[model samples]
Target: MYGRMNNNIYILLFCIVFLISIITFTTIRIITDKEREFKKLPNLKAWKYISILIIVAITSFYGVEIYKSATNYGGKLAWFIERLKNERSVKFEHNNIYEFGVEGIFEDINKEHPLPKKLYMASDFDLTFNSDGIITAFDTFVYGKNAHGKEETYLIAYDKKKSQDITIIRNGYANPDYDDDKLVEPLIKTVNAIPVKQTVSKWNESKYGLVYYGKRNWGYNTEGIININEDGKEHNLEKSTSEIIGYTVSIFVPGKEKEVVPARYNLIGDPNWSKANTNPNQKSSKEKQQDLTNSKEQFYLSKEVGYKLNITDKALGSTFYSLSKTIDGGKTWEVINNDPFNGTIGSASGITFLNDKLGFLVAVRPSGTEGELYRTDDGGISFKKVNYTPREVKLDSGQSISPFDSPGMPYEKDGVFNMLVGQGSDGDYNGNSSALYQSKDKGETWEYVKEVKSS
Candidate 1:
């Protein structure tokens, strides 16, 4: 598809260049000819008329050609955009793992799409817990054969304990035999199961919106953003799905939970508000960088100074990771510096500030060599590299791994900082089985402690 588009662009460029060359040649000849020679030329009026006619003919021909080309190209582009903007209905031949861990199984069903007596495979498929580990909501991925035994995937939301269903999504894939209840058109936007971290954790409680993308579908292919609560309660956000493509969205913060920010890639209430178009086909590199700069931001509030820090991560490029300060609770932000963090961040990164002037930043090093750790004493204005012995530990599977391979959030208590670094047992090598290390002197020295298990 891209190759064809490139060919079209090449053709258009060639035609433009050819027209410009012809016009330039004609003008040069007209200007260079001597007045006597030019005037005395036989059939000069005929030549002038002929030239005008030829130019008009050629212009008209190319205009029509260009118009046809553009129309066809525009039609194809619009089709592609539409395909992207909507949920794609697909057929399932066998059991397959679709995007967002959505598994489709060709199975048997009765005359209606009734609740399964038992899940084909079970164990917390959709139940999301609260901070206290209590079930808050369950976004069930209901898949079964309909009246005709055609396989279909359905979505339904339920409150805690799965006692009451609140919403149902009818994707029109297979009309499930409804029992008196009118089947409202289900919003087919794919969503990953919202983890308890986003639902109940304090770090994510103050977010503005929700952003989710599947691993198989990179970028905006399988991404969704909405202003609905975890239980599918809509807040009138009315945002188009396309607008959430490149945004790193989160939920609304406390006291602002009811606020609905429009579709924007950056912070909603930012003083320097800029809506970035994340469409790869329509956006330039500079625009993408700006959008990324606004997407991944970390906020920290100091108890003593009452100051707030916002660290923006512009990853996957050479753009600097900026540090911004907000004196008044995120109403406005001023960029303090973008140079403090260099080669200290990767796609998966995190930042933590102990106070107004003390903070730690860690990121996976470029090319996955090791995790880089940085510390800021004077409120993130400047950072100094802190050295530690990267743990080389063995898991139960007898696989050798490095702690720096999978860096995680640092836990600090009584000036004793425990860096919970673990080597991922999974294929991705993310630190799943973690080990805790003590760094009493603020990341200067480290001592290995017992292995820590992720709760």
Candidate 2:
């Protein structure tokens, strides 16, 4: 870039010099011709002086132009040019630039696991491939919320050796539980190398609780420089960073609609159905379901999957919520569960699904019991309670809240789930959460990714 700028400066100076020479010569010739016509050399010296003055003025004008051009070319233009050049280089050898055949591997993955038809499945992957162009693993960051309804980050790792994928929530760089058949050491190193914490930090910084860095928005935090080797040694990567003011989303266009749509949202309040459930005589099951459904009737439609949640008082005055998903728009809904509590001594708070069959639910008791997590593999036919402890929501006022309320529905992208856990007095869906948790094993187990402050 500097070299090109220098060349331009030289060319501009040459043009200025050439123009000045012509102007000076023209002025002198005019004066001389007038003198010859008059047949007298009257004030020839003064005319010469005038010609010199004219040349000086012309030179000064061109000199200013040259300086201005240099300034623009070096300041804004230079940065733009360098960025463009780098981008072009990346595009030209995009497949091999990041790593040999990185693009090809992505293309293959997309072709092999095309987005699910009749379902809004935006399959966006954050991937790291081996040197041989074999995809070793990938990650998906959830901006909105997970099955548990908290906005957090989850990780789904693919081990080539095992030919299987496993999800896990990060606990401050702690390694996830790997299956016995897979090699844990390499997968651990790869997961650790990814800037999962940094990505979550960006999401927390966003007012809308999101971090999507890619080629969709005019190079806004799109590209990076990194090295990949077999040793698993830490490589310093220079990433382009952006301070996104709010959460923005675009479904990885494929299955149904080839468009990137922003995730629509609404805030939920304290369980109003508590009274209806507490007094079964007050409201019938249908009435209670309608009430719960009416409150959360608004749904956000991604590519193929549409998510809607209803919190109602169904059992013993406890909170009962159902997570309904529609694959064919609003025409039909395949719910994970009709009654989230299911005789358990807790209230359903949040829900999220990684796919059709695998899903998760969050529940808490009104009697100050710790939050409990449940998972279902057969599309919510039945859920098994998982033994997991949750972190308490520490308020700014030095008070603590438990059984995290998922104001924002849990967001699931790829195979990862993100949820925010917090308690608020206002009873509205505000992101004033104490912590964010990520789960890869369909919410069966979650690890603390980070603490998120209310935005």
Candidate 3:
């Protein structure tokens, strides 16, 4: 809507200029008619009509614009006029950070704002909070047109406790004629210039309290370099290709004001540090191989007692399964059985334990059309495949089909073990509804109850 208004304004100005030019030329020609060539002139009546139409069009466009300004902008005529003069717009975005153990007005420039050709706009607002939800660090950028109408990009970093603001000129064309000594800082930090699409924050249980990570392209042209200005001296550092193509992780720990290190520093030696420091989205060759060869799934029956299924040795599209028990809150694990599914060749979809000695493990084939259900009576020490009894289900379309192609783990509800069996991708009857089966005798045998729709 705003774009259409701007276009209309431009068109209205053009028409007004055209009408003025036509009127001025006609009047001059009539006054200098020395040869009495007024009768040979173009249709003056038509020109007068054209001029009236242009005037009416301009007036109508202004009337519509004024109405819109009154309705949308609370009748702020000066504000609307200023927006027209600058040919720019501003938008606000607010983010809720309560899930990150912090609550504040995390408002910043909307990412949908038009990119400035000469100026750098404030694209993102990043905050680092402590364990108690106290904001310790803030990172953002400031941008606007200078007195000479040139754009300026200033990277800003604020320390909450120190109450100091660190600003750095990002773009090469930024004016440095002002007092640079006051802007010089002992601690210079790099900030993201591009708009951040997604941000992930993790609680570092080691040294750092909370770590905020932001993902964006850090190529040579996009990477933000910390250009420190000391004693009114500014330096523009060039980006190198060796810079890792990964996300930037900001580590902020309370009470360590001066120890804010770069994301490249693996101070905590987290296992995922190497992966995130390299390429976060892409997995390495070794990691991919490991993913294909090995997998683990855990199900906790209680706060301290849990069971884990480890599928390993992927050969010939099959893998060996083992069940491990952890009684002391995952501190130690004990492998009870080497082969729970009697050497089944499928992926373990789920593992559920009703008690310490009774559990079920489900293994689904790669096609997901069929699966093997194993039940253990002696706490995963031994296992035997349980064949589920199939029942015909009548669909709304009057078609009867067995919908128990893939069986899920049994969950105890209302003193009964209930399980849902899906029809997999091959079945599309009744919106791919699952057949709910209930076991009355502790999952010893199952009976068909009813059809359950996939929500």
- Tens digits of per-residue lDDT for model 1, 1-455: 32265657977789799999989986787788857557777747898899899989988986676555443223344334433532232222221122221222212111233533322210013333333433344343334445665544443444534343233333312212221111111111222223324333544442222222111111332222333333434333334333332212233333443344322112232212213345547866754443332211354353112222232322111123567776753445667766666644332255677777877766553223345567788888888876666667676899986654455566688868888765532323443556677887766667878667656
Q: State the lDDT of candidate 2 residue by residue for 208-310, as single tens digits.
A: 1211222121112222222223233333224434311111122121222222322211111212201113333465555433332222222323444555655
Give lDDT tens digits, candidate 3, residues 355-404.
88898888765334667677888988998787778878676789887767
Which regions of candidate 1 deviate over 4 angstroms? 1-296, 302-320, 365-370, 394-404, 424-431
Error in Å for residue 404 of model 2:
6.1
Q: How high is the CA lDDT of each candidate model? A: 0.43, 0.40, 0.51
Which regions of candidate 2 are displaced past 4 Å?
1-316, 319-328, 332-338, 345-348, 364-372, 392-409, 412-416, 424-433
The count of backbone overlaps in candidate 1 is 4
lDDT of candidate model 1 versus the reference: 0.43
Which residue window of length 10 is worst by lDDT in model 1? 179-188
TM-score of each: 0.34, 0.27, 0.36
The global Cα lDDT (0 to 1) of model 3 is: 0.51
| Clashes (N, CA, C under 3 Å) per candidate | 4, 22, 0
The TM-score, computed over Cα atoms with residue i paired to residue i, of candidate 2 is 0.27
Tell me the lDDT of model 2 at 16. 96
